[model samples]
Target: MAGTSDPLTPRAKLAVTAGKAVAAASRAAGRGSGSVIGGRVALKLDPDLLARLAQNLDVTLVSATNGKTTTTRLIAEALKAAGPVVSNALGANMPAGITSALAGGSESKFGVIEVDEKYLAGVARDTDPKCIALLNLSRDQLDRAAETRMLAENWREGLAGTKAVIVANCDDPLVVWAASSSPNVIWVAAGQMWKDDAWSCPSCGGVMQRPGDDWFCGECGFRRPTPSWVLSGDHVLDPHGSAWPIHLQLPGRANKANAASSAAVAAVFGVPPQVALERMYQVQAVAGRYDVVQFQERDLRLLLAKNPAGWLETFSLIDPPPTPVILSVNARGADGTDTSWLWDVDYTRLTGHPIFVLGDRKLDLAVRLEVANQHFQVCDSLDQAVQMCPPGRIEVIANYTAFQDLRRRVGN
Candidate 1:
């Protein structure tokens, strides 16, 4: 019986009001953004809070192992071409954080949510999104998150029978399988870099035949669907063969791929490709992913590389040889305690750069670098690493919690 026309009950209204107050207090105390704790408080007071708050809006949920925060940001900005949009812009993807975002912007006409891969189905069911964008899946947080195939199967079951039109990357075999249950799918050719996790077919336990960009299961006859939207270099070609240029302030091919996906999601909500690209071009940073700051009079560009796949993409984005590269890592719960994924990364690619490692788990990274025969210094502090380097343009690459710690230390 709950509908957009239904106003929040007195109890739900009180919960929203209380959540807002707690959120404000937390922000004032400088504890953190307070999205999670505030949402938790609200949900405890009213279990049906998220569903009620999203009733009036057209929701679009985005999920992936990597590029999630950045993709969610791009989608939210592009959707602004439609009207006011409510989004959890600070990378909070859980139900509690989602409840906080929706309650905060109760009157917004649309909602763009970035969900952790594990919780995508639950959020989709609760929000009943008009569309869902599935980017690509790779190994991430092995200790805390589900394996790629299992998660993709979870997505397949969770999204089945939902009326939401799925915009998925056909280049990823697992994503293709995940979106298979949905009748209405808008396949996009967003490239996948890490093939280690998806070498086998999720449908039949057979080896996947990946011949360049196209992948298929010879055993089960599962194949990559033809993508209506294709990303070629910096240009995105639409179904009509109209190539649109993405004038993004964010760097790297990964972000350009995100733009293509964002455009597709925006189009589902009636926003034109040109208009969406215009709005997306204005976003320079997503929670400091590509933020440049001054440290010891040097310009340090911040890049986040959490897992092996993410690290590979990030390697391509760093400045050319001899430019000092500071690599920071953490084995905290957020970054996944198993540091074994480090060995999977081709650290030899970092050979030419003057490398420095500093983090709670720098020792793990140092050992990996040593085994790869790549020269790097282990610094006790981020400032020490920066001071060791000469003049301008230092690259600071860190995983999740380390990135947060560096940002907080930089007073961002």
Candidate 2:
């Protein structure tokens, strides 16, 4: 509505109309990616549609290697208490997707956007977000994103011009380095479980010392920033040292860290921590990250893990040994072509559990499991995999394309 009011010229309005028509046609034709197409059309016509639409709006941009979608949803849900909120709920996180979301919700004055890691700086600069949440950074989409350190440097440079309040994860050294230059930063020690990607100091390139949960560089004396918000046990510790219990429908400690970061962002907008936590508890599933779908006689709990770091975190959320699990891996564009990251995952933890592997890269996963000495059966289809599992709940953990395939097959 910011751009739709009187600020937009007649030509801009016409471009918006044409883009909307194309999006509508795309949806009717059964192509689910209408948003990106629409945004592309609008941008091609005007070129500055995103910046125009973002003017004068209160924006919060959420970015991370993982958990961007779910964390953005949680932040959007909490922000809804203040008023109507706009967000990219469908997980189209690039410039075009973000432009489409803003164009669709033109009337809303507040927005929470999930930004792709590579596009974080550009999106933040264009949107001029009031609060920018910097979640943990790790090795992701190596084919396109190059190196994690380079991505952090891009973020550091991109955010140097913004006046936005920065809420960052102190547990991740990369996040700390990226946000260190921000004039106004609120550090949160939202637990970091995976350390394989961050063994060395990002600042001095020295060996990082991790005495406990806190990390520091022994060479240049670059240490983890003292956090104002921290996830301790089952509660989130506020700046005042008061603890607030976290009760979420979403599983894993990763989600808890996400909730803590969301709460911190909400607090920047004057949203009470209690209200934020209460609203977070109501989030049953984010896109298809934690959805349970019934396939034939079996109920499958879906968990999406795109890389080694993600797999490590997701594996901890399992119900433990004796619980039957299905693992799906794909080498499609969305899942990244390199299936070598599978070997980096600690599959030995899954040894005692009954594992069923299925996907385009099922054989690749099968080999990895066999090398790890984990007992697993390879199924050609989801139905066969579901039937192979013991009666009751079956946990299905998959990469990008495989996860989407499962969601579509089960009608989730």
Best by TM-score: 1
- Judged by lDDT against the true structure, how good is candidate 2? 0.88
lDDT at 180, model 1: 93
- For candidate 1, what is the lDDT? 0.91
Give each model's whole-structure lDDT: 0.91, 0.88
Residue-wise lDDT of candidate 1 within 1-412, one digit each (tens)? 1355755899999999898889889999998988888999999999988888888889999999889899899999998988999999998999999999998786688899999999999999888899999999998888878889899999999999889999999998888899999989999998998889888989999999988788999998999899999999888888888999989999899999999999999999889899999999989998988999987789999999999999999999899999999999999988899999998999999988999999999999999999999889999998899999999999999999999999987766
Candidate 1 to native Cα RMSD, angstroms:
1.3
Number of backbone-clashing residue pairs for each candidate, in the order shown: 0, 2
* Candidate 1 backbone collisions, by pair: none
Q: How large is the C-alpha RMSD of every model relative to the true structure?
A: 1.3, 1.6
TM-score of each: 0.98, 0.97
lDDT (tens digit, per residue) of candidate 2 on 173-223: 999999988899999999888888788888878999999898899999999
In candidate 1, what residue range of length 10 has the lowest lDDT sum? 1-10
Candidate 2 error regions (>4 Å):
1-5
